[model samples]
Target chain A: MRKIAISDGDIQVSTRQLPPEGPEPKPITPAAKDWMLFLGFAATVLTMPIWLQPLGAAYPDLLQKFAIFGIFAIGFNILFGLTGYLSFGHAAFLGVGSYAAVWSFKLFTMNVLPAMLLGVLVAGLFALLIGFISLRRAGIYFSILTLAFAQMSYNLAYSVLTPITNGETGLQLRGNDPRYIDRAFGVESVGLPQTNLFGIDMSGYPGFYFCAAVLIVMFLIAMRIFRSPYGLKLRAIKSNQNRMAYTGFNTRPYLLGAFVISGMYAGIAGALLAVTDPLAGAERMQWTASGEVVLMTILGGAGTLIGPFLGATIIKYFENIFSALNEAELASAFSFLPPPLQEFAVTIVNPFVGEGWHLTLGVIFMVIVIFLPGGLVEGFRRIGRLFRGRSGKRTASQAEVQPAE
Target chain B: MDAILLQVLNGLDKGGAYALIALGLTLVFGTLGVVNFAHGALFMLGAFCAVALNEALTWEIVTVDPTRTTAWGTPLEVRQPYLEAQFGDFGAFLVDFSVPLAILVAIPFMLLVGVIMERGLVRFFYKRPHAEQILVTFGLAIVLQEIIKSVFGANPIPQGAPDMVAGSADIGAWFGMAGSIIYPWWRIVYFLFSVLIIGIVFAFLNFTTYGMVVRAGMQDRETVGFLGINIQRRFTIVFGIAAVVAGLAGVMYTPILPPDYHLGMDFLVLSFVVVVVGGMGSLSGAVLAGFLLGILQSFASMTEVKAILPGIDQIIIYLVAVIVLLVRPRGLMGRTGIMET
Candidate 1:
């Protein structure tokens, strides 16, 4: 055998030379990869009506919810996923956005553009005020502070601010309301003016496309933020805030910026809700609504770019599809079995569907939090790794072992 | 003077309920380091225990009596409660006092629930982040309330106080007041019951050796564990005790607020505010903050106050919570670095 020269005890020196440098290789750069991701996301969202048809979720109302809540969850992820600040008052902003949009429809014009702008502006201001007070404390304190402010707003909206909010009846488009823009333009309608994008009514497929476009744009912005230096600073804040502070980094402005942006996103979603439905209810500001956004973020994988969107889609799908499954439908579905067995199956499955959809949601949420803390995205990654064969396994094991050294 | 006194009384009654719930919350937070979002569910379960017991006691045996005919020419039905038939007066007494009697059943049932939850779920989450703990417990809360909703339906079930204490009491006479200061008799009973439970818990924690070890564990689990103590077991028992306290509070509160499936959620948010305002891990602080917020809430609801500040009562508890959190970052009696991270 040839004599082997050992360097540093553990290293065996080999007489191998590195490969020679070649001409600059054409590679898929990070920018190109991001562009691919954006295209893929846009394709998925734009074609949802086609793909989601098989799942019975292609209707305008449910599709609109998917887009609206997708935007909400994406915005929430920027704050909760990156900064690790769990604000339980985000629904207040959503409610504010809806109210602003409705008021815009009543006073300005039936066009969605001005309504959305006003909604976002009002929501941003509200977020600035709440975030200023709540960001003073960290951890659970911050969550409670946000929750308190939201509850206060909810209560005020329900009672004291009835004149502005329209109270329990919720703010709705009135036939006689002075639409100055529409009036000045000499555009008069016989019935309640439908919320529109110029001349296109925002109640059907066209509306879905509009919301889809906004969702795609929001997703692109979120993706940009994820890959940007600001996102890296946010991730740093999440990992270790004190260390960042020690490094002379002022994290407050960054946090406030993320918060206001997320609030504006929620506002846009609220405006979209009014664009489709033209109503704003105090119930939208309830803590449960806030919790729903939180659940969507966590269920989709908070830190991941597309996780919240996926989560919102899954939840809204469940809300619409599962809840619509009545006893009669379930009974017929199980009619192929023997009478006794069929009855047993229906009884067993009854509480998890129909009016009991929330139970299933709770169970799924618990299971996800317990087993897959990284949410469905993490589950998908695990499954993908398993299918990638021995080479993938070897790399994963190597990655795991490298940490020890 | 009477109005102020009445408001104060109203505050005390509400405070009793708040203190009871917040006390258990603080205990669990202190010993287990778990933020149980399902504590409110435990209280709701306790109230349902009363409903269940009442339903059981009043379960009627219906028989068609051929001797008597109905208007439609069918045999008349005679219904007698199984308990009343078996135990006579005692069974009737049981039905009448089922709300109070629920305390007996709820104690053991809630203890088992608390222990099961600790061993099966919460213990595994002890090492997780507070956010995860809150999320998991919140999911559990939803699961519990949903199950209750399925069983009880979506409406509030009315539970009655015993006939002996159902009427309003002349408390003004006892206080030597001018105007008749009337209050519900059951409310007085609930207030007393809460004080008794609070006293018992305090005495148990402050007087017993087991309590001493648990308190030690709360302060420094590692040190206590290093001393050859099974701090984990003690913490589990502490959790059971906390559940018992919350359950009893619920059991007694049914007559005041009918036990609905959503009752727990309504209280859950406010109780959290109470806990945070009292401080994260301080028992006395929790109790103090509970009463303080309760009193403030009742006073805010006064017509005079509402006239000055519209919707003050609706948001007073949360307002106090926000103010307290901002002014005293650690809360009234919160120790430094408990849940600061």
Candidate 2:
């Protein structure tokens, strides 16, 4: 029933971590890197909302929401992309962070910074617990185990932890609960220097600027991690886990560490959301939510630095914006058309838009998987390669192959 | 004593559903090696089949005769013989006989769904990693559920048994019993019906020519193909059979628990854990694990146990799965050659 391996082949498919003794790859010059990053960021600052604001039909709302989700997906990609271990329970960590942040607002404070930190810390702990048990298995079995854990967390949150999570009623601010850190009524909170943190009055540009600052800081840290030696080790483990184990390296610690760190990143995003909304619910922890991020990462282009942002934006914006196009809205929009044409437009576009957004998403996802396979990022590179021919071929390869392998 | 007996009876009925769904899943996984994340959706489709049949059976007047009313003043006509005969006395009861009639009609549609799903979506993922297969099927299941929700709003549609089976059937006196058991008669009928269907499936797989081919194919698809047997056709038929089993389970399941858009998701996660703990591709193993897990869960929910622990019921099944995975990775009855860890 089996054949013995007489020799190793040219494919060199080693299931182990690469040797640590191998020459440590030279670091990118900080000056060149900072220059590259700053130039790109500067370009984005100039082009955003102002240039995107007048896209007429689409709205800057679309771009703004996408950026938020992109952050979520990017954090997730750090765990799944680098480690090659898919976590079905990652959403639990995010939900835990959200609940923590919201609870902070509910009990101690409305200050965004504290709420965000607490959310991240709580999510990190949850990830630690789950990863400790589940990381015992590998491949598909490991994924299923994590899945079971997530479902368990979801059920417990919805039903048993109803008092804490407020169950299906969802926790909302009715201006009743005593929030300790929230109100100065005059001075700005830590989140924004202009308004009170909780009941604080940091209402105007100050609050927006605070959130933007946090996003920029998070982006910088992520970029640093992406280029660091630690990141290279993570990729080595991802490619050949068993080989690493046999090479006298305890791969578990590295893998688990990456998982917890990524989970903390998700927590930060969750905290930001909760502090912004000041509410948390068990629905945030649903299995569907986990699936949503997976869709975002793959759809945007997994592993690429910028891919997660693009993916997250598409999904989140679609979620918020698409839901706005209700049947009444669709019907009303076609009102100026000819009677026959108006009725036809309503019937044809109705199912694929608005309440039918999930249908559109599922269709797009399937098409990408089958045709483009590498996702939106790949699709862009392909166009660029066509004109440059010999010169652009390598540029195209760098983008596509780097993200994939 | 009565409470204990009632709980045991309840457990058996619940276990019947668990066993049937797990059995079909095991059948698919064992031969086709698919985890079948959409199996629960198939079960939901089966329940909706009953709903479809119920809609189709709206009574119409045929040969209306004044004499048919007698004292009730309701115009009687020759309705479908099944509903007319079953609900002669208690026509006003919540149990719509149309749902029961739909069970038979739904089988063909369920089989078609099974075939179409496998050919259209599942076939492409056969060579892919298990995660990819799970992801794609999971997507399909969500789409299916949402489509159903959009079409029929997310509410638990109440479908009951026929009038005669609406309330408890007193088997009290037969076993030297003292009081009424209070078990719904339809549940009793459903339990017996499931056993019969399980028997038929077993016989079809164990004693027939098709069964022989499928069994051989399960062992080695390539060898079966090499031997001039059409493994693809056999797999299709096996899939059809698997779907029918799940559908029957769903149809009979209607009265016990009303069907809802989210009902499938609620059942699917646990059933998957069941299949895994039972061992992939082990039908008998799934049946054994299903009943055991069901009974254990009921015991976990008991007040006696809750006296010590507050939320024992929710974690019991998952805890057991973790323990089982640690102790016996291949499951108690797992075949040596099939998905051995």
Identify the candidate with maximal lDDT.
Answer: 1
Error of 1 at A66 (Å): 0.8
Please report the candidate that would top DockQ against the real structure: 1
lDDT of each: 0.90, 0.71
Candidate 2 residue-wise lDDT, B1-341, digit = tens? 66676666666777777778888988988778786777888788788777766654545335666667746678876545343445654443322676666677768888898889888877777787676677677778777787777777678887868877788866665566856566778878877877787788889889999898899898889999999988988898788889888888888788788898767777777787777688767888887787778777877788888678766788777777777766777665677656553
lDDT by residue for model 2 (A1-405), tens:
001111222112242234779774444444455558756853563355565455432343344344445557878888776776777777888778888987777666656767787888898898888888887777656777778888788778876788888888776654555565544443223332221364443333344344445556666676666667677667778777768778888888887888888788778777766655566777777777888887787787766666676787667766666766877788899999998999999888777677777767766666665555466887776676687897566544443443334
Chain A TM-score for each of the predictions: 0.92, 0.79
lDDT of prediction 1: 0.90
Which residue segments of model 1 deviate by more than 4 Å? A1-25, A393-405
Shift in Å, residue B63, candidate 1: 1.2
Worst ten in a row by lDDT for model 2 chain A: A1-10
TM-score of chain B of each: 0.98, 0.87
For candidate 2, the per-residue lDDT at A218 reads: 65
